[model samples]
Target: MKVLYKKILDLEIWHDYYLGQPNPPKPPPTGYDISDMLALVPTPECLRVLRNLRWLFRPQPRGASIFAHVEQASSGDFATLLPVNRPEQLTFWLIVRDRYFANFTNLPLTTNRHQIYYFSNLSLNQGHALFLTQPLPNYAANSEYHLGQLVHHDGKTLEALLYQASASKNPNANDWDILPNSQYVSELDRLPQQGLSRIYTIPKANPGDIWRLTLVNVHEQETFVLDVTTPITHTPGDAIACSLNFSGQIPGCYKLCLNNIQVDRFVLCDPIASKDAFALVEIVLNQSLVPSAFSLLQPQDGNTLIKPKTYVIRCKNRATRWRYRYEKPHGFSAASLPNFELIDAKTYATKRPLGLRLQPDSLLTDGKDQLLPAPAIALIKPETDTQAHVTTIFSDIHL
Candidate 1:
C-alpha cells in the first residue's frame, strides 16, 4: 500500500494504498516512487486542483519515513522539503532552502504560481504521510506582502513556517541650477576730436638771411580760403610773402591769402640780435574755419647755442627771398657772398625752424682783447640801486 498527497491554490489530492505489512522494507517500490509522482503536478491546472483537498483530520499513522518533493514552473526546478507537520495535522509547511532555487524567477511568486505536490510510495510510510499547502506568494516585487504557514496533524499538533520578502533597492539623485549672472557699458564717447600740430621755433635773421614760409594742414579735412588778405579764406593752401630791407629795427606786420579766398594778418616783433628774441604772428580765418584759428611767433635771429664749441644760424620763414653779405672787421667794404643752399619754400608757412652751422676759420678777439669764437650771446638787465642797466654776454645763450 502507498499514499500520495498534493496541494494547489484551491485544491488538494490524497492517495492511500497497502504495501503488504512492512516485511523488512524490501527495496523501495521500483515502478512508482512517491517522489517521482510528485514531480508531475507543477502545472497551473494541477496546482489549482490540489489546493481543494481536505487533510485537517488525518492522523499521523506511523510506518516508514516519508520523503517529499516540490516543483515550480517560474523557478524551473524541484526542491527538497522539510517535514513541517505536527501531530494529528493534515497540512505541512514546505520550505526551499537552496539559494539557486530561490532566485530563479522572472516574475514574483505572488504573481507566478508555485505548485506543491507530495506523495509516499509504500504502505510502510502510511503513518508518516506527507502534507502540502498553498503556493507561497512572491513579495520580492512588493515587500508589503507576507507569507506565513502552519501545518496541523490530526487537529492538535502544529508546525510553523515563516517567509519575508523585501522591496526593490534604489540609488541616488542629483540637481544643477544654483548660481547668478553679471555684465554692463563704458565711458569714452564724451571727448572732443583734436589733431597733432608740429611745433616750430623761430630763427634769428640778420641783414641778409633768407626767409621761407610754409602752410601746414594739421587737420584731417582740407580747409579753404575765402579772402587771402582779409582774414576770410575758404580755399586751402593759400600763401603770400613780402620783402623788406633790414634797416634799423621796425615794427613788422603783414597780410596774406589762404586758398586765394581768405585773408589773414600777421604781426611780427622788431628784429633782435640775440637768439632767444622772437616775433609773434596771428592768422585769422572766416567764421567757418574758426575751429582752426592759428597763430605763431618766430624769432628773427639765427644763433643757437648747442655746445661751447658749436652754434647754429637758421632762416626764419620760407616765402621771403634773401641775399647775404660779409665785411672784414677793419673798415673793409661789404660784398655779396655766394655758396648757400636755397631753403625749402614750404617749410616756413607752417613756421618750421631752419638751421645752418657757423664755423669760424680763425678765432676772433673781442673789444676786450679776449679770444672769442662763434657762439650764442645772452642779454640781461643789471639791477642798480634805483634802476636796472642791461648787460650782454655770449656764454649765456640757450639752444
Candidate 2:
C-alpha cells in the first residue's frame, strides 16, 4: 500500500520568496532552528511525497532536492501535497506562511488531516516565502502547482475557480502514481511512426502487476497489443520500473494504468511546435531581441489569452494597452477563450521587421561565471503601428 502524506504541523523555515512577487535579496530567518523536524516519519510514501515539495528548489519538474526522502518528515513543508488530501476529503493541507503565521495565533491544535507551514520573521526587510508542490501523478518532474492566489491584469476573460469533486475512490487503493524518469510523453505521441521509448519509476506496484497503456480517446475501443515491453528495475515497497515502446500510430491522449486504475494523462502535441520561434521572430524583426524574444498569433483588443506567452506590442507611440487571444493548435480540439492577465511586459523602439541591424562594437562579459559575451540589444523604435503583428510565441505552458 502507498502511504498518503497528511497531518503536517506548524513549521518555520527561513525563506526568500513570496506569492506573485519577485524574490528578495537577503532573506529573513524563519522562527525555527536547523534541528526542528515537523513531527514527520520516514517511509516510502513520504519519500515520494517529499520529491514533490520544492523548498529552495528550482521552480518545477523538480530535480533531486535538498529535502531528503529518509523515512522521517522534515519539521517543515517538505512533504509534497497529494490531491486527495483536500480539507473535506480526509486529507487537507493548511499553510500559513511569513507574516500570516506570525499574526495569527488562533490555529487549530490538531488538524483532522495535515498541515505544512512557514512563518515570516518579525521584520519587513527580509524575503518572504511562497508555497508550491507537484501533482502526485506521472508527468515531467518540472510539473508544479501552487496553492495560493495569483494576481492578474485586465481586459481578459475570467472563469469562476471551482473545485469539482471527482467520483470517490478508496484512499488505500486509488491514488496518484509518480513516474520519476519520464521526461516528455508528448515527444513519442507526436508522430504515428516515431515510436516513443522511455522509462517510468513506479514507487509502488509489483513488477508483474498488470501494467497497461490505454489510449484515452480510443476508450471502449479495441486494445492494440503491446509491441515492446521490458522490465528495467525495481526498488523496495514493491516499486518497479519498465521501458515502454509503442507505435506513434495511436496519436492522442493516453493513460498508463495498473490493473484498471488510471495513472496520468499524456498527450502528443504537434511536432511542428518544436520549431524555435524566437529565431524566426528575430529574423523578421531584423535586429536581435534584448534578453529574450516573444512571438504570438493575432489577438483582439479586449480578449486575453490564458497561455503564458508575453506580447511585446510596439505601437506607433506608446499605445495605452494591447490584447491577445489563443487559437486552437493545428490538430487539437477547438479551445474556448480563456481569461488572460498581464504576468509581465516590456517596451521597445519598435521598428520595421526588416533591414539588417547594425552589429555592436563591444560586448560585456561577466568576469566570474560567463565567458560568452553578453548578447547585444537593439532598441530601434517602430516606424508605425505596423509593428503590432510581431510579438508572441509560447506554447505547451502546463500548470
Candidate 3:
C-alpha cells in the first residue's frame, strides 16, 4: 500500500479500484499502467490470499533494502515461491534493472485450472509484477521445485511434496499429491525452521563445474567460505543452482562472492528483527581508500576565544573524505558517536553546531555551555596510495 504515484494517471487509477474493485470500467487518459496491479476482493475461499500478499510485500526487513533484495534476485535467472506465502502457491519474479535476455524467450504461466498465458522475456524488468498470483508452468523432468508448488500435468493437478530438489515427478505416485476438488483452504502453515535458506542460479554455468562461494559480513568484517563443492547440474537452459544455506549463523548484511568477485549483496535478519528497518551500511568501497592525517591549522589546544552558536576546527589535509565527532557533556563513546562529514575538501574549517539547554536557575554567561571547551576528533581517508588507512586527530575548541 506504500506505493509512489508519480503522475496524475497513477492517482486516478488508484481511486477507481482501491476498494478491491475490478479494473477501470474503460481505459483512462493514461492508457493503462500495466505495472500497477489492482487486487480484487478475495472470494470466500481465497480470503487468506489477500492477507498473504500483504505479508509478502510488506516493507523490507530490518537492516535490508528493496534494492538489495532485487540484486540477489537478479544475480541469476531463477523461479522460486515467496517463502512465507507458499500455501497460496504464488510465484514471485525478481528481474534485473537491465532487461534479461533469457535462453527460453517464451515462458508459460499457469494462472488457474483453465487459463495459461505466454509472456516474452522482454516483458520482464525491475518493475514487473512482484507475485504472479498464479502457479508456474507444468512440471518438467529433472527440474527444480520448491515446497507447496501447484503443478498440472497430463490430466490431473499435482503439487510439490518436498522442499528444494524435491521429487521431480508428479506427486500422485511420487513427490506431488493431488488436492481434493473443493473450496481453497485458508489454513496457514507454520514457518519452516529448517531447509535451504536461500537459492541462487548461475547462468551459463558449465555442467558439472564447481564455483567458490564466500559470505562476507559487512559489519563483523568476517568471511566464511561455504562448502559449495556439489556439482551443478545443467538443465534445459544453461542456468544452474547455487543454493546458499546460512543456517545457525548471525544474521547481518552479507556479500555473496563467486571466485573472489563480489556478485551480490543482501541483508539477512531474524523474524523479530525483520519487523523494523535496519540501516543498510555498505563497507565495500567502490574506489581506492587511503587514510591520511592532517595537522590542526586553527583552534589549537590552548587557543580559545568567543563564538556564538558554532565553532570551527581547521585542518591542513585535503582529504577525499572527512568525518568528525565531539564529546558530550556526560561522556562520549566512540562507537556510539554519530559522524558529521565535511563535503568540500577545499574548506579547511569544520563548523560544529552548539546545542544549549537552559535552566531557570542558570545564567547564560555562567552556564556549562559557555564555560567548557569540547573535545573533538576528526577522521580522514585520502586517496594518495592504494593502502587503506583511518587517520584520527583530536582537539579541544571553545564555544
Candidate 4:
C-alpha cells in the first residue's frame, strides 16, 4: 500500500478540529489509486513531518500476510484473543462523514473498548470497513453505547492549553500573537473556530505497551495509563490508535508525561485570545513553490545581532520557488518598522524582518506585480478573481 498518502491523511487529521465543534465537511474524501497518491509525494520536509508521527502497531497471525480495515466494531470484540508484541501499536482508519459532523453517540470510549487493540487479521476489510462516515448509518444503529462517531484529541487545542499551562512557569510563554500571514489567523477569520485545534503527528509510541498520559495543570494533578491491544504476532506491520480525551480539564499549559517518561506535552490557550481572528496568510518561497526558511520579526525593538532572535521556516522542497503564499493579508504595512516593502517577485534576501502584529492599510495584491505570474501548470492556480492565489517572495526588505 502507498505509505505517503497515509502520512498526508494522518497530518490532515492531526491539524483538523475535533468534533467538539465541526466545520463544514468537505465532499466525500477524494479517493485515489497508487499512481495519484505517489504523485503527491510532498517535499522531503513534509516527509520529515510524516516521519515524526508516532507509529502504532498492528499484529497479524503467523500466515496472515493480508489484513483489512474494520468498520464499526462490536462490543464483545474486546474478549477476542490475539498474540502479543512489545513496543507495538495500531491505528484504525476511521473516516466518517456524517450529518452530525462529530456528533457520534459512541465517541466517548471507555478503557475496556479502546481502539488501539481493536483490529485483527480476522477483521473484515470491506473498503468501507474502516471508514466511519456519518455516524454508523441510522440503519445499523450499533446499539446505543457504541452509536456515535469517535473524537480524537485536537492537537492545536492541546497546544493552546499547554501554552496557557506553561505561563504558570514562564511568563514569556504566552506569546499568542500569531504573526501576519499565519494559518491560524486566516482560519479563525474564515471559520470562526477553525485552527484552534492542532494537527499533531505524535512520535512513535511502543506497541502493546500500556503507555501512560500525565497531565499536570493548575486544576489538579491527573494521570492515566493508556490501554493498548495489539494482536499477537511476532512479525506484523501495523499499529492502532484512538482519540485522546482531555475533557474536564482547565485551560492552561500542562506537563504531559507519558509512560512517566514525558514523551510529549499539551497547552491550552486562553479561550478569549484564541477567538480573535485575522486574515490567514499562506506563504511559500516564490522560487519554485517550495518551502523556504524565513523569519517573523519580534514586536519589541531590539538588536538581534547581539543575540540572534529569529523565527525560522526551513526550506524542505526542491520546487523552484523558495517561498510561496497561498493567501494575502488584509494589506502590507511595515509602518511599525518602516524598513520593509511589499514583496512581489522571487526574493533571495536573507534578512527582511517583519514586526509582530503588523497590519496593512489595504491588502498588497492591489499592486500590478504584487504576485508572481503563474503559468497554466504553475504550482499555484490563481483564484477566480485572477488574483494570484499564492504570493511568492521576489524582492523587498525592511529592518
Candidate 5:
C-alpha cells in the first residue's frame, strides 16, 4: 500500500520517509530548511488542496498549477526513515518580500486527507528564514508520477520552495514563474495624452496645373504650420480666392484665409466653368483674373413670319441672351417656300442678304385670307447692340 504523510503544522504532504519523523530532541539555532528536499519531491496532494483553498479564498488565478500525477515510494516502510535519513526534506522556508500578508497573523493550515506524522513551528519574516517541516507522503522520484506535472507558489509567500523547484526541475522555468507575487506586481502609471491638427490643401490656378505640396501637423500634440512651395501672389490690397477642383469634376466650397486672416468664402459651382457660386455682394476690387470659359445654350424669344406669295422671308433677333440656333420650318408646300442658302459676314459680306433659304410651301393662300410665311434663318451675336436679320426669296416667284 502507498503510505502518505502530512505535516502537523502546515498540513503539506511530503514523499520522503524521513520527513514523517518527529522533530529531533535537540533544537537548532535557526529554523530548519526543508525547502531543498521539498523541491526533490512533487507537490503533495495535501499541498495541492491547500493551494486550491488559498486560491478560493483570495479569488485570484495568480498561483495555481495542475498536477499530472504523483510519485509513489517503492521501498519498504518509507515513512519510518526518521528526521534525517529520508530522501526528501519536510520543512520549507517561506520568504515574504513586502507586507503582503501582514494582516493574516494566524493562518489556519490544512492539507489533503493524508495523515501527518510530524511538523515544526511556523515563522513569518521579511528576509530569508526557515520554517518547520510538515511530512505528508513518501514517493520515489520518476516512479509513478509523469514528468509533466506543474507546481505553483507565490515568490513572496514561499521563495525557497520556488527556488528549490527551479533547481530540481529539469531545465529551470522562467524567472517570472518562480518569483513571488510582490515581485510581479507592477507600479500604477499612466501614459501621456496627445492631440492632432487638421489637414489642408493648396489651391491651383489652372485646372490641369499640378500642386504637389500638402500641409499637415505630424506631431500628435503640436500646432500645424502651413508652408507652400508655390507662394500665392495677390494684388496689394486684394484678397486671394482659393478654390478646389477635383480632377475636372464639380468644384467644392472652402474658406479663404489670407495670412491666417479670414478674407472671403468661395465655392466652385461649375468645375468646368469655375464660376464663383457664392461671393460677397460688394466687389471690393477687380482682381483682373480671367474666369474659365464654358459652353452655354440659351433659347430664342420671338417667332419668325414668312410673307405669302413672296419667296423672301425676313426675321430678326428677339432674344435677350445670344446663342447659336438652328431653325427647320416644316408643313410648307414645296413651291411656296423655295430652297435658300445661309451666309455669314466672313462668307457673304458684300451680299445684301446675309442668309439664304429654300423649300417653301407649294400651297397658295386665298387672296382674302392672311397666309403663313416660310421659315427664316439668321445668326445672332450675344451681348451685341445690333439685331440679327434674315432675307429669303422664292426661285420661281419674284417680289
Candidate 6:
C-alpha cells in the first residue's frame, strides 16, 4: 500500500471527560479510514484536521501495532477471529468514512459475545492501522451490579460499586467510578488544531507588536524585507502570522528571519518546470527559536590559546552578520575587533590577538547591512587565558 495519508485515532470511551461539571465536554474528534467491512472510525470533529502522518516502529508486536479486519458476515453479523502475536496487548482498527458511514450507528461490534482470539500469520502489507479495544457493554436501565465490572455509558467507561451490591437505573456517582481505560486513546500530536494553512505563526506576542520578516538570498546577498504589525484586537486564539509574499524574488537558498532571530532557511526552486510547484514550510515561534544561544567551536573551552587565534561560534540559525568584543585584564583593549561574518550557515569565526578573551555576551544583527534591535545571546568564553611569551634582548650593548 502507498500509505498516502494516515492519522492516529485515540481509542477512547466516554468517561474520559470530567462529568461533575454542568456541561460535560464532548469527546475529541478522531480520524478514520475504510475498505469493504474494514473501516476506521471517524468523528465529526476529526474531519477538520485530516492530514498525512508518518511513523516508524521497530519490527515488534506492539499494543497498537496489530491491524484487525472486521468483516461483515452474510448472517447480518460482524465476526472475524484475528490471530495476534500479542493478544493481551492487542488493539483493533475500526474504519468509517464521512460519505460511506452515517450517524455512527449499526457498528459491527458484538460486545455481548466473547471475542475469540486465534493464532496465525496475519501481517498487514497495506496501509497503517489504528487499534481500538473491543468496547465494553452499554449501561442498562436497571441491572444487578457487581464490583469491578466495566460498562460503557454515555461515551464513558464506568465500573460497578466497589464493595456493595445494588440495582440502580441511573448509575450513582458513588456506585460507579470512571476507569483508567477510558483515557486510553492515541492523540494526533503533530497535527495542528488550526489545520494546515500554508502560513507561519509566531506565538506569545502582545497586540500591536511590530515583527519583521527578512528573506536573504545566500549567494547574491540580496534581501527582501516584509514588516507586519499585530492588530490591536483579534480573536482570543488567533495567532500573529508572518507574511511570506515572495513577489519579485528569485530562486535560491533564502535565509529567513522573524525580527532579529533567524527562523528558517529555504530554497525557492525555479518555477519554470511546473507552474503549480510551490514549497510549504511551517515554524513554531517561542523561546526555542531564540538565536542568541550558540556554542564555541574552535579553541575548546578551558584550553589556553596562542595569540592571533581564530575563534568560531555556531548558533542554531545562520547569522548573516555578527558582533564580537574582546576583553583584557588591567584595562588593556584592542583598538579594533575583527568584524565577524557568516563563515558558514551557522558558524562565525574571527582572528583575535592573544592575551584577550571573548566575552560571553553577544548579539546577532537583524539585517546584513542594517543595525536593528537584536537580542543578546551567550557567546564563547574560554575560561583559560592565552599564554604570552616575552623575549628579552641581551645584545643591547652592541647598539
Q: What is the TM-score of each candidate against the true structure?
A: 0.11, 0.22, 0.22, 0.21, 0.14, 0.20
- Predicted structure 3: lDDT: 0.29
The models' CA-based lDDT, in order, is: 0.20, 0.23, 0.29, 0.23, 0.21, 0.30
TM-score of 3: 0.22
Highest-scoring model, TM-score: 3
Candidate 3 regions off by >4 Å?
1-196, 219-222, 229-237, 278-399
Candidate 2 lDDT, tens digit per residue, 1-399?
554433222222221111111123222233313222111122222333334542111111111112212122243222232221211100111222223221111122122221122111110111122211110122222222111101111311111111112312221111121111211111111212112554555666643345554433323332333322334453335656656554443333345554455655443222333111100000011012111222111122322111112111000111111122224322211121121233322211111111111222332222122222211111212112243321221111211
How are the candidates ranked when ordered by lDDT, highest leading? 6, 3, 4, 2, 5, 1
How far out, in Å, is residue 39 in model 3? 35
What would you estimate as the lDDT of candidate 5?
A: 0.21
Query: On a 0 to 100 scale, what is the lDDT of residue 244 in model 4?
Result: 55
Model 6: residues >4 Å from true position, as ranges?
1-198, 219-222, 235-238, 270-399
Native-vs-model 6 lDDT? 0.30
**Local lDDT at 339 for model 2:** 19
> Which candidate order results from sorting by TM-score in descending order?
3, 2, 4, 6, 5, 1
Lowest lDDT block of 10, candidate 4: 311-320
Query: How much lDDT does candidate 1 score?
Result: 0.20
lDDT of 4 by residue, 1-399 (tens): 532111101112211211111133221133311121111113223233223432122212110011212111143221101111111112122222233221112122122211111111111111212211111121112222111112112111111111121122221222221111111111101212211233322344444544445555322345333444443541234444444555443333345565555544433332343322111111111112211222111111211111111111100011111223334342433332132343443222212211111122222222233533221111221112233222221212221
TM-score of 4: 0.21
RMSD of each: 63.4, 26.8, 30.0, 25.1, 50.5, 35.3
lDDT of 2 at 259: 46
Q: Which scores better on lDDT, 1 or 4?
A: 4
lDDT of 1 at 343: 21
Candidate 2's C-alpha runs over 4 A off are 1-195, 218-236, 269-399
